[model samples]
Target: MSDKPVAVIGAGLAGLSAALTLQEAGREVVIYDGSDRVGGRVATDYIDGFTLDRGFQLINAKYPELLRLGVVDELDFIFAPRTIDVCVGEKRIALGDPRSNPFASLNPAAGTLIQKLGLVAYLLRTADAAKSVEEELSHLGKLYSRVLKPFLSGVFLTSPASVNAVIGKGLITSFISGKPGLPRKGVGALPAALAARIRKIELNHRIDSLSQFENQEVIVATDLTTAAQLLDIANVPKLAGSTTWYYEVPQELTGSARLLIDGEHRGPVVNSIVLSNLISTYAPDGKSLLASTTLDFASESEVRRHLALMWGAHTGGWSLIAKYDIPKSLPIFAIGNQSAASSQFSNNIYVAGDYRTAPSQNGALLSGRLAAQELLLDQGR
Candidate 1:
């Protein structure tokens, strides 16, 4: 390995993962981020004895990269219910494994037996075929409105019509194949754990131009916009935006850990969950915490109206804890985007982020690992 130190820009999951991998391979790596703290998008806050993640995020235990990093065993995780609750007009419908909850199998809200069977076959086939999710699901006339649209919007952060089928299949498979859970501490704990293994990370140190470090080995692991700006690249993919609101209530509105979806697409609230129900440590002694997400900024009144529709409980008493708005939340994945391919500006410069891979935590880690591997290969390791 070379004695020269490597420079990793952005202290997000990708940057941290690259730094850790390079260090393990006997390379001295230095990480720098414009923010004072690490885990750029994957951030968490402590407020009034509650752990509020920047957005409603979770960790899929089956991610190969996460397992490789031993993250599954590093922190205490609270598994989310396999089934999801979709709020129709005035009822809540559960959908998932029938054995765990027979009610889900009997819920007519999902669709008729023929529609359900067709939906299953469609999802399975879509998993193998190279089609857009909207293109494939469009054939299922009623099922799209009843089941797919509301459920998928929460996952893709956009209408199901826009998300690539392959990405949808990957997310669905991850959800079904393994348990998705939250770390007791928060979503930030994942990157924090990775950051702990590194010896040095320069915080609040932004790199305006790569020209300054022209002679050194560099890996840009920032978000899409920032990465493009640093690399002076054009026509970068657009990103999805999201706003999450955290509320502390006197009592638990939903007793289960399952996700609650807005089936009707009536308003700003796309999905919601009682964080306290999933992890008791998320709230204080007697209070409960509810985290809800929307694609755009939702006023307090709009949030209350949506909650009232979903919960049927008077939300006037609920206390607003925090509201997080992330403008560049995720990279928009298109069918022909060169997502799986790595970008090499030169032999000593590389770009790594979720935008280069699938848009998920696994993709971020995988991209970082690939960047480090490319560097190692250059060093003849």
Candidate 2:
């Protein structure tokens, strides 16, 4: 191998992961990012003493990548209940992870007793991996409408029918096995923890051409669009987008840490959370922070009304802290398509991103590790 240090473009989670993996293997690695921050799409904006993530994101401590990277215990993680609160017409339903809280989904609004039993049964009996999430859950009529659709549509940022069954499977298993939440510092703390281990990360330094890193192995760990542009690959998966609105409400108005979804599909906001309820540090003393996410952008008044409906409160006093419009959030996995998770782009040049994997932090980290390992093997290390 050449004596020159390995160059990693993009300081996102994928780039950070690749750089760290190579550094651990006794190789010199340097990272370059175009943005001022390191977390990429998982960034957090501190506005008026409130922490607003770039999008609605969660950190699952039990993700194999986070555990493997040994970042599970580094920061203070505020875990939400392993339950989803859905707002049906004129009523709210709480659905819990059957694996851990079997009785949590017992309410009639959740589904019939038989339907709840089928949820557990279907989870045990894995569906065909090459099916659409919609197809996989089509058997449970009420469960699909009342619980899963809104919950998943919020997370995936697209229709369930377009998402692969493998994604649905991953979601079910993670919720069953993992505790999903945000760090006390915010979701940005996740990538920050990973980047802390690596030595060199040059932010606001964009690498436009591969020829610049002369005589050095390079890893393009940028987003799917940038990665493809650098590789001159024209055909790539389409991207998904979302809009999130953050409001500062009175501290007196709060709810459970569980995520709230609009099951009735009555509004533009699909899901929301009382952020301060989950992590108090997200807001200032005597104040509260709330976030609502939607696939389509809605007016500020519309968002406030939708949030009020979900939280069952009057949001007239809620002030807008910040609003995020992320047009290229993640890749939309096609139905029946399998996990990409590929890093073997070329002999000397490699690519890593969630687009190459499953479109999660775990997938981003795993892709970086795979890229570094493949590069190491090719170099006869």
Candidate 3:
């Protein structure tokens, strides 16, 4: 082996995945993170006899690396029932099964004729595109701009139009196509398992900066904000922002995951509302659990008001398990002039995170793995 070792700079999904890949390839890998804990964004905290995830979180079977790790089986996943309620003004219609529901044929959004035809067109086009998964995702990216955007604006609690088409398509694939399964214990268990398999990890060491070495390789897997701090980029500072709330109620909320629209102008208020009992491990024998998220850019007052609307009457001292702004929770995956960070300095260096381009868990994981594989192959591993 060469004297050089690979250094993975973050312990989140990306960093862990990269480290694991490098380890498998027989590389001497050392993982570093600023946080005391190992799991980065896939955060789960135990509080008041409850497991609270950082934000609205879900683990889809379609996730390639997750499936590869076999952690899904170890956690004994509980499938969330295929359900979503899109609440519009006056009348709330269940979007039914994006796969098998006939509601689209009956109550399409536009005019009656247009809605019906649109529904038919959508189904036909979707069916046709389904033959090729990648093509289907590309097609949905286009539909996101047209159909899903206005509806998802409120669903994701942000402008769907602004979200990256690829990321939006992945979300649609997870819901309409992939099987949804959450950990039996909680999101924390998954990361804990990954950390166990990893070799060397340095916790509580915030990377102050990054400098190139002739033979050793450095992989910067931190979020944009942290990455900026290490790389000395002025624009990286602006990317730091995140908002999320985790609530551990007495018991599981008896229901399916609901996508609640504003019910007014239909602007994004909150993304998908999750019922944690769907994953039995989080809730007690008779209790339920739930977690929701808000945009990082929103002000404190704005978050409070949204919580009032979303929580509605359950605002009592319900054990605020964990609450804080991540500052760099997710990258802004919007259109034009949004933000872009890259590993352009040296061929020996690589950058991987949701901030690199796509801003989703899957993208982050895939980027990490890809960057590692690319580096390893380049080194003739």
Candidate 4:
């Protein structure tokens, strides 16, 4: 029905996936990325003859769209099943394979009572709490007043009352239940593979503003906060902020073991470190990739100081790979909030990104596939 190619802005996983889907459906699609590279947050940098991922990036094994794209086979991936050596002060909790640890089973009542209550509170904020994860707190009623509120604040690094319930539920369903895995080559491989399928990407074409064609359509697929201002769409869903740090540790110092520390850790930084050898083959000859995730409100100095402490305490003298800060890593998905798909705005225009489906390779890929499906359905194909 339409002759004009679908215009996908943002060459992240979502945009690339959407473009590929359109191409597969025998439609012309052109993708534009502001950055010189493809993957937005899902990025990797080649430095000092080593490849380092931006943040602690990983893919879930059960991500359906990722497996469907055929890129999964092209990329080398490894499953990080072990949740061990999660340090909390004196105790090193084995959370990876909790079943393997007899201690966790033996003592159900451990740690501070606040921590115990927090887990119970989090459980109450289950998927069925509201219609959507981004639902307003008012509709949540007692659920927010009693449990959902604080539980999410601690996890997402944002207040539950402020976070949209609809998005929150999506995060819980995708992350809490699913098994998260890492890529062998790096996070960039996933997007690179996706971009490879769609050869019409214009890099360094960061669109500052969109000129809405009267009949032609444009889909702005980006962060909701940014998307709102870009498209002049109000009530664009409220998203909380997040911060992440990328660091590499020497393998001779830290072995191939994964660590995930929660809020109750030390200082303002909720530090979680993972040994690189367990995740990627390109970590380094004798060096391990160490990734640390911190909360949004945390001070940069706090992260740097704590990181130095971690490295100093663990490794006597290790090379600091890079202390890079990612102010925004993951989208804050709250319950009950609904974002009108940009692609749905017009028959010719459509938006696709991880935010639309779920913030991962799976979500990004699915959003693209869904957009293409919408186009095809419109054509009565």
TM-score of each: 0.94, 0.95, 0.77, 0.78
lDDT, candidates in the order shown? 0.83, 0.83, 0.61, 0.60
So what's the TM-score on candidate 4? 0.78
Segments of candidate 1 deviating more than 4 angstroms? 126-130
Query: Which ranking of candidates, highest TM-score first?
Result: 2, 1, 4, 3
* Model 2: per-residue Cα lDDT over 86-168, one tens digit each: 88766877777666667666676667788777777878886676788888886787788867888888878887888888866
- Among the numbered candidates, top TM-score falls to 2
Tens digit of per-residue lDDT, candidate 1, span 148-203: 77777777787766677777777767767777999999998888888999988999
Candidate 3 lDDT tens digits, 50-135? 66676656777667667676677777777765555444444545554645666553554422444444434554443331132233
Q: Which scores greater on lDDT, model 1 or model 3?
A: 1
CA RMSD of all predictions: 1.9, 1.7, 5.5, 5.2
Off by over 4 Å in 3: 89-91, 98-100, 103-105, 108-147, 150-157, 164-167, 211-214, 237-242, 247-259, 263-268, 272-274, 284-286, 296-322, 336-344
| lDDT at residue 147 of model 4 (Cα atoms) | 31
For residue 71, model 4's alpha carbon misses the true position, in angstroms, by 2.6
For model 2, the superposed segments whose C-alpha errors exceed 4 Å read 98-102
Poorly placed runs, candidate 4 (over 4 Å): 97-103, 107-170, 173-177, 212-214, 234-236, 248-253, 280-282, 297-301, 304-319, 338-343
Worst 10 residues of 2 by lDDT: 338-347
